[model samples]
Structure formats: structure tokens, C-alpha cells
Target chain A: MTTAKRDTYTPETLLTVAVRIFNERGYDGTSMEHLSRAAGISKSSIYHHVAGKEELLRRAVSRALDALFAILDEPDAGRGRAVERVEYVTRRTVGVLMAELPYVTLLLRVRGNTTTERWALERRREFDQRVADLLKAAAAEGDLRADVDTRLATRLLFGMVNSLVEWYRPQPGGGYEGEQVAEAVVRMAFDGLRSGG
Target chain B: MTTAKRDTYTPETLLTVAVRIFNERGYDGTSMEHLSRAAGISKSSIYHHVAGKEELLRRAVSRALDALFAILDEPDAGRGRAVERVEYVTRRTVGVLMAELPYVTLLLRVRGNTTTERWALERRREFDQRVADLLKAAAAEGDLRADVDTRLATRLLFGMVNSLVEWYRPQPGGGYEGEQVAEAVVRMAFDGLRSGG
Candidate 1:
């Protein structure tokens, strides 16, 4: 018997399937045929919802980029001390990554082989630069350590955060939540792995 | 006139060229023809050195995996206090990642769509588990913080380390070296981002 889940598919639903396929098969290796087979939809139906694979990629990466860019505009990220602002952005970035894990995973893996991929890479760099600026200001304020380079610290901090995509799988009734993970990230970034000072 | 570089293309040398292409084009997206064109050699010549693209992938990933596994067997990593051992592994991991950047980059991005990809992933997980065991022992020894889960901390630590693949480029006389980066990583990870902590 056919699954009832296949009865109806919107562009948004089609995108969810496409992104999963894209993640499984490297985006360069995936095609419309793969999406159609995964979604249990016809190629015409897939095209009817979206222009093509590139459009699906654009839509997927945009979801991740939009969520990330939004974090920079939040009052907490802008109205506080640079160090605090960096912390705020770091926490929210982790939250967004956990929330939008698949899309961001795809975003992080883009190789700049296509126009859509190149655009995603450029936007990601812009986001990283904005956060790097916050890190620079924190260093200038003497709130951050002098020994570690601000640019290197910024990369490491986000690297730790962006890594959630690699292994974090959400559970319906799991013990860990995004906020708790964010708290741990902030503590680790600010205080470190060792207990106490 | 042909460059002197083209004069010799041993399997090891050809594997380097193939790995770069595998990284640029996703492994599944790459083929014998792609490797041939990239290496300035014919498909037959490429085959003469290595069996196929998968063999090249195997060789490259084995290089990365071998380097990483060797770290666990190092005297410093084996004979220290749990905390110190973890630190040693962490520092050496960053060094190995830098020295084998392209190979590890391809290793990290493997999607597990093929048997070789799946094997690479399994070996990576095995390595992560070994490191995680070290982190767990450190926590049990009361050297690490109790607040953060050991598993979570292990993931974050490596996440920060693994991220070097995204942006690190080696220079013959670069301002930053792997050991320096490793020191900063250990500092940020053990001490943190705030000043005078």
C-alpha cells in the first residue's frame, strides 16, 4: 500500500525532501530524478513546484542564511558590550543551527561549483565577517584575551557552534534542548572545559 | 614547455591531484575522466598508477586516518594524566589536520554514499569515540567541568578543531603555523575567551 504521506506535496514539502536527498547525495551528485524518486512524485510535479534543483538549493540555503542574518539584527546582539553581544550571537547562532540543522548542513557543504552555491558561500562569509567584527571590538575593549588572535578566536568560536550540524539529531522527548546546548556552548567559550578558574 | 612538475606522477603524487579534484567536485560527482584532465594525464595513465577514482579516494582518506590514529598512540597522548592526554591529542589533532588539510577536508565532507565513503565515516567515528573516551575519563577524574556533558564537550572540542579545513591554507612562510594554532586552541578550550580568567 502507498503511504498516505505521499498523497500531497507542496513546494515547501518538496523542498524538505530535496534537501534531505541533497544532503545524502552530495548536491553536485543529486539531480531532479533523485528528488522525484525520494519524494514519490513525478518529475513534472517536482518542476511544477520549483524551477529545478538549483532553485531548490537556493531556497534551502536561503532558509539557513535568513535565520543566521536575523541573529545579527536582534537587540541583544547589538545593544550590549561587544563581548556580551558576541556571546548573544553565539548562543542564538547555535539555536538557529539546531533548529535548521539540515539546511545549514547543506549550506556548509557548498563547494562554489554553481551560481547558487557561490552565492551561498559569499553570504556565509558576510555573516562570518560581521561576527568577526564583534570579536574584534571585544578584543579592543580588553574584554577578550590578548594571547589568542581575535580573527582566529572568531573562527574557532563559530567552528564549535557550526559543528552542531555534524552530529546533533533532534529527539522528540530528548533530555537535551537547544537552549541548554547554547548555555553549555557559552560557558565553554567563556569559561572553558576545566572546572572553576 | 611542460612544467617539471608534470615529469613525475607517482601513485602518491597522482593521489594528491585526484584528492583535490574529489574535493572540488564531490566524490560522487568526480570520475576517471575528471582525474585524468586535472592531472594532465590520460585515463589509462591514471589507471596505471591507481586502480580508479575510488582507489585515489581510499589512498587520500587512509593518509588522513593514519595520521589521526597515530596521534592516539603517541607517548604524550598515552602516558599523561587524562586531562593532559586529552590536551595532547587535541593539539596533535590540529597539527595533523593542518599538515593533511586537503585529505582531511575530503574526509570530513564524505557523504557515505559509497562503500569507501561509508568506511571512511566508520573509521572517523571510531577515532571520535577514542577521543571521547579520553574526555570522559578526564571528567571522571574531576579535571573537567561537571556542568557540561562529556559527550557534548568532546563533540564541541573536535568541532572547533575540524573546522580548520574550511579556511586554513598553508603558506611556505606563513604568519601562523600549526603548532601556534594548536596552542591557541588549547588555551581557548582550557582557559576560554575572556581575559584574566
Candidate 2:
């Protein structure tokens, strides 16, 4: 409405708006017009920040992928028994997912409808393969159960971890802390869910 | 195309086509024109099968919901010890999810943008609550671990179970059978993924 309001637009602020709309209406369904309307900026101004909707998508998924891949390079993720390293990765992943919920949420929901989406999917698969190899190593070391297929187990583990995006809402004032959740995931995953384990 | 080919469009077959399109292009992104094209029929012909795209959505989600709700009523889900009953429901949930993969995928992905989607979401929450109650009963009976929140455990359990839709392609001839996948899910959820009990 005013010059001052229009002057406030930045790439970071615009991206936050874009990611929210992308998650709400879906990446394929959203248009530059939709992002313009949601961000309260003109389409030309948006182009000043990023080339187009796809670039915004690329930035968003890259944030998620970077955080995820960074977990693998951490010292804890690199050292210790294969199972402990895998567990360390799992715990840190839950942290990254919660800390960057919206970005990771968008990353997971990309269906490969565009070039950017396909890239996200490929990077995601690379991350999963890395974790699966860790699970296989843990299995070989007699830490993870050998009865279940490694790839399948890896999918299920991440499935449980990723399902957080579907239902986990951060409550800063009260309710389960993220640490509590990470611990719960570790326990249910490593120790089993049944009593007397 | 021959008149005979055009005449072969049953409501059932048309739904198969509609759901595939809906899953491909999201429900909001799809149109009657798209459905007509995908179904290989005229717009009027598609109208004759159902009222509109919403009807197709409703039918597809209802199929998934009915299958899932039916699991709760099975003898194994009802008659066993609380923990055993919870495990039975979990295993059967995996089976139904695999059996109705596309429909369930659509159901899980619904964002409640339309009346039909909202109804689907409400029904889904009700289904989740029923399973949560089973987990609570198991915890109350001292069969499930008490330290973790029952609700969180329920979500994680179904998270693991529902993740099947993300990456469980059925292979009729050589790959894992439905029963084997079901057994794997049960083993993972009940006993945990550790090497030894």
C-alpha cells in the first residue's frame, strides 16, 4: 500500500512467504502470481529477489538437503560403532527436521514435477542411501536386526522420523520438547516398543 | 477409437483413471477437462459417471477409509490382549495400506482444501484416535513401555506403518510378498529394529 511497506521486501522474507504458500497449495499448483499475491509484493519485485518460483523451490529444498547431509559429516556421525553412528545421525536428523520443519516439509513433498523437484528427489535419495548403508553396517556388526531388509528398515526409520512433519507442532511454552521427541524416537527405534526390553 | 471402446467406461474403471490423475496432479490442480482427457472420454461422458472431480475424490478417499476402518473391526484387532491387539491392528493396517496404496496415498496427502478433503481428514483423525486408544490400553496393561507418551508412540507406530505407501511397490512374482512385508512391519514395530530382543 505504501512505499515504506514495499521497501521492506527482502529475499529471505519473500522465501518464507513462498515456502508457506508452496506447502499450503502445493508446489506444482502455485504460480508466480500466487506468490506475488501472498508475499504482498509485485511480480517484478519478486524477480529482483529470485528468478522465479522454481528458484525459490531450489533454495528451499537445498536448505533441507544441506542440513540433512551435514549430519553425516559430524564427528559423532563419523566415529563410534556403526550402530552408534547411525543412532547419532538419527537423533541429529530429528533435530534438523524440527528446526527447519517447513523447508524439510516442502522438500519431502516434492513429487518431481519439475527439474528442481527432480533434483530434490535425487538428493533425497542420496541421503537415504547414505543412511541405509549405515544401517547395513550396523546389521553386519550384529547391532541392527538382520531379519528385516536393510533398505526397508531404513525407509521405515525415516518414515517414522519424517512423519513428524505431518503432526509435530512446536510448542515453546509447554508440551514435549524436541529433545524428548528425539529421545523417544531413539528408544522406540533401538530398544523396541514392547515392555521388558 | 471404436464405439465399443468408448462404451467400456464403467464408473469403476473411470474412478481408477480419476484417482491416478488426482494423485499425479493434485486434487486442487485437476479439472474436469483433465479428467475427461485422462479417461479417454468426452466431458459429458465423465459427467454421466459422476457429478464432478469432487465425487471422484470422495469415492477414492472413501474406499481408503472403509478399508482402514474395517481393520479395527476384525477379530484379531478386537479379541486379543491389548498389546497383541495393537500389534494385530498395526499388521493389518500395513496390509490394507499396501492393498489400497494409491487411494491411501491420496487420503494421506489430502490438505483439506475442499469439502470432500475436509471430510476425509476428519475421518482420518477418527481412525487415528481408535488406534491411539488401542495403544493406550496396551500401555495401561503394562505391555507397552510406560516411559514414552502413548499418543506419541501411537503416531510413531502408524508413522512407521503409513510410511509403507511412500515406497512399497508390490512385486507379484519375485519380490517380497504382502505377508512378508506385513511380517517385517510387525517385527520392526513390536520388537524394535535391534539385533536381539
Candidate 2 local lDDT, A57-113, one digit each (tens): 999999999999999999999998998998899999999999999999999999897
For every model in order, the fraction of real contacts preserved is 0.74, 0.65
Candidate 2 pairs with clashing backbones: none
Q: What overall lDDT goes with each candidate model?
A: 0.88, 0.88
Instruction: Please report, as a residue range, the 10-residue window in candidate 2 chain A with the lowest summed lDDT.
Output: A1-10
Candidate 1: clashing pairs of residues: none
**How good is model 2 by TM-score?**
0.93
**Candidate 1 overall lDDT versus native:** 0.88
Backbone clash numbers for all candidates listed: 0, 0
C-alpha displacement of B146 in model 1, angstroms? 1.7
